[model samples]
Target: MCVEKTPWEQVIDFHGHTCPEIALGYRVAQIAMRELGIKPTPSAELKVTAQTHSCALDAFQVLNHATYGRGALIVEEQGQHNYMFEYTGTTVRVFITINPEILDHLVIPKDLSSRREVQNATLEAIQFLLSSEESMFCSIQKE
Candidate 1:
């Protein structure tokens, strides 16, 4: 019985591992979809502009079908967790900026190099990202 993977599982597999940034990307992608009231399709695709190059972008690639090869994803690397999403053939655009304070709380234990400890910390951070309220983690602007 071959079963298909969930969207989240696909994202993790593509990203090579589970991490907080991927979780953040997942949440941001969901918010973008909700705010814009649309999903990316072959004809109506999404153009995503990412402020930082991180694991989170993988989520957009999986969920929004926005890929760099197709010119649907752009990364400017501004060192912040900001994302702008626009659907093709539409005037609506959504901007999401992640709150720094929320990121501050997700600090990984740098002193502990133990693989188990690091994995645990990353899992905890991913959990926090997944559970946080949209308003608490990011500010959304529509244009």
Candidate 2:
């Protein structure tokens, strides 16, 4: 029997491997969906603007269907983990800014030379991003 993949599994497959940035993106995408209400109409469009570039963008592509190729996704480098999601059918746009404190906490120590240690650190960070309370890791505003 063919089984369906969970959104997280699909995102990991699209992004190649699991990492903190992808987890961050996954959370951002999920929040955007909640704020905007899934695809409201058949013709509604989703436009995404990312404040900084990272593997997280891939999550938007996979989960939100906001792809760069179709010009639905854009990056304005402000060196921030901020994201904006605009749905054509909605009057309000959602803006999410990841908490800087959380980002700081997730940083891996540079001195760890062991590959297993690096992987463990990365996984721990990913788990935090995936499970933390929305308010704990980011702030959401609709405008």
Candidate 3:
């Protein structure tokens, strides 16, 4: 008799004032998982605790080329929290709790030109990751 191992559910939680940023984070994680060849449990809801510096650093490193100089500085602290993940059966759910301090760190530049540049760069990185063949196997669900 052969016993089957249950699939693992992957979950990511992003907590931030900027909805777009949180959504982008979700997309990035989904893509990463796809690249790694891991299948997320169909309906497992995972409670992702907080977003740590390591996670931010990882994103910065990967998106540095795309963000140019804008990516170098931590314009927004985004707070210090964990990403909680929980798996039950075939479903996966993610939760991201944002630290209030993160809002205080948002720096509004004087010029829109610089802001646009950074935005464009970030968009490029997101596009590149989403379009890559490696992102085909990952599934991202926001909570």
The C-alpha RMSD in Å for every predicted model, in order, reads: 1.8, 1.3, 15.7
Clashes of 1: 0
Give one digit per residue, the lDDT tens place, for model 3 in 3-119: 653211111222222222433444444433333233355553322233454333333223221122443323333454334333335344443343344322223333547767767
Predictions in order: lDDT = 0.87, 0.90, 0.36
Highest lDDT: which candidate?
Answer: 2
* Candidate 2 lowest-lDDT run of ten: 100-109
Ranking, lDDT, top scorer first:
2, 1, 3
Please provide, for model 1 over 63-90, each residue's C-alpha lDDT reduced to its tens digit, 9 standing for 90 to 100. Answer: 8889989999999988888899998988
lDDT score for candidate 1 against the true structure: 0.87
Q: Residue 135 in candidate 1 has what lDDT?
A: 78
Model 1 weakest 10-residue run by lDDT: 33-42
State candidate 1's TM-score. 0.91
Residue 1's lDDT within candidate 3 is 94
What TM-score fits each model?
0.91, 0.94, 0.29
Model 1 stretches astray by more than 4 angstroms: 39-42, 105-107
Any residue pairs clashing in model 2, and if so which?
A: none
